[model samples]
Target: MADFTGASTGGVSTIVTDHAALISACAAGEKQALKTLMKAEGGRMLGVARRMLRRSDLAEDAVQDALVLVWRRAHQFDASRGSAKGWLYTILRNRCLTMLRQEDREVATEADQIEATSQEAVLTAAFDGLETTTGLRQCLERLDGATRQAILSSYVLGHSHGEIAGRLDAPLGTIKARVRRGLLKLRECLS
Candidate 1:
């Protein structure tokens, strides 16, 4: 066995040396080589997946899928364009992104159903139960017209700062500043 550990200095680099040989061994149906590759790279791959998915179970799933892919498609890995480590990570990243896109679609479909409840309806229900509405109204009244409008567009109408800027014919920075200042004033008044 060639010294799999190369002279590179980093943690990943230490394990990633001679990836081509490991991948070739996998391609040649060497199960121990595949196991060696997994032993070396699994933790880092899981970390990458966890960062991307933000959930342990999802990260594990992605890493498992990526390993299965590495097993089946080991013969397809081309060493000319990039390192074998890069190829492995590309597969893992793609799997994570695909899972995320699927999750986003599921959430979007669910959100479509929930969107029938207007923000105003929700706010009205909340304010109806709270005695702080009077204080909030008074604080809002103290704001300058532009700042108040910015806050209202953001909090009441659910507009993004960019959208508020477009609607108010102001720069994005100005809109952000107005909203920040307005919130600070409201906070001071409420406290």
Candidate 2:
């Protein structure tokens, strides 16, 4: 229950206290100890969650879930093995990763599929509608096939340079260079 100020938190002085004792109090169903723990570490916890989750809303959700878990599992915390702060962050990180995994596993609905297909069709039509004899199309055709494909994948197909590199089985740097050099050549040809 002793409190002192310290600079351990990235130059920000926060009241230093025994997190283990706070957790113990929480384990004993002391609500005030939990509030004190949150007051001391909530911002840091949120920051950790935000970095892991990326999206603010998702980070908030993860932190909220972590805090709830901490409340429920306080009795299980073993201070001899690790610090309470480390325990808190582990929970937050696990929650964030779980959310990310769940998002990856989500099945796209029929509406989502149709929307994606329509968007892809629009981009494809725009690229295909370019007349073969037109100056732009001629310039694109003049480039090496790999370079032209790289530029088209990035600009018209809306793929990232990394994605284009993966698709072409080329290095990321090579894909980026192709797109840059192709654009420069096209500008010179157009001008």
Candidate 3:
């Protein structure tokens, strides 16, 4: 264990060294090596998984399964072929992609549908409850339909900017700008 703390310093060489040492130790059946690797990169790995899988539970499962594979296949890593960090992310990404493909085939159960409907109802109600005469409502009404829809789809409907962009058939950057400017306008109006 060569000071895992050095790995967090954001230097490329230090990260490579730490990951290489950890992976080598893992290949040698050192259980602590896997723990150290997880401690060092688990958050980033989970972030990547979450971005790919969307669902937190599924992202967690993907990260766990990727770690298991890393333990089993550590011996296959070749520093000459690529950096240790890249190798590790490659394994994690592969696991996430596999899980995503499997998820595509999964059908929503009745309970899942009910839960989603209730959640949507709650979100919709929050938006609907805004009194017509309130400053917020009046400010929202002042926005153009596209901008207003972008803001509501994100804040009220719980959609990702990317999802809203796709739904509106607009560029992602445009959708983001609409939301940002829309909020700024609302803030100015309320003030």
Return the TM-score for each candidate structure: 0.49, 0.49, 0.51
lDDT (C-alpha) at residue 69 in model 2: 87
Worst-scoring 10-residue span by lDDT in model 2: 105-114
Candidate 3, 43-106: lDDT as tens digits: 8788767655656798899889999999999999998999999999889888876665456434
Q: List the residue pairs that clash in candidate 2.
A: none
Which has the greatest lDDT? 3
lDDT of the candidates, in the order given: 0.73, 0.71, 0.75
RMSD in angstroms between candidate 2 and the native structure over all alpha carbons: 16.0
Record all residue pairs in model 3 with backbone atoms less than 3 Å apart, i.e. clashing: none
Q: State the lDDT at 57 in candidate 1.
A: 86
Tens digit of lDDT per residue, candidate 2, span 143-170? 8877876776554433567656876898
Query: Per-residue CA lDDT of candidate 1, range 107-190, in tens?
Result: 634643555345435434433534655897778778887787677645433356875687679899988888998899999998
| Residue 60 displacement (Å), model 3 | 0.7
TM-score of candidate 2 to 2 decimals: 0.49
Better TM-score candidate (1, 3): 3
Better by lDDT, candidate 3 or 2: 3
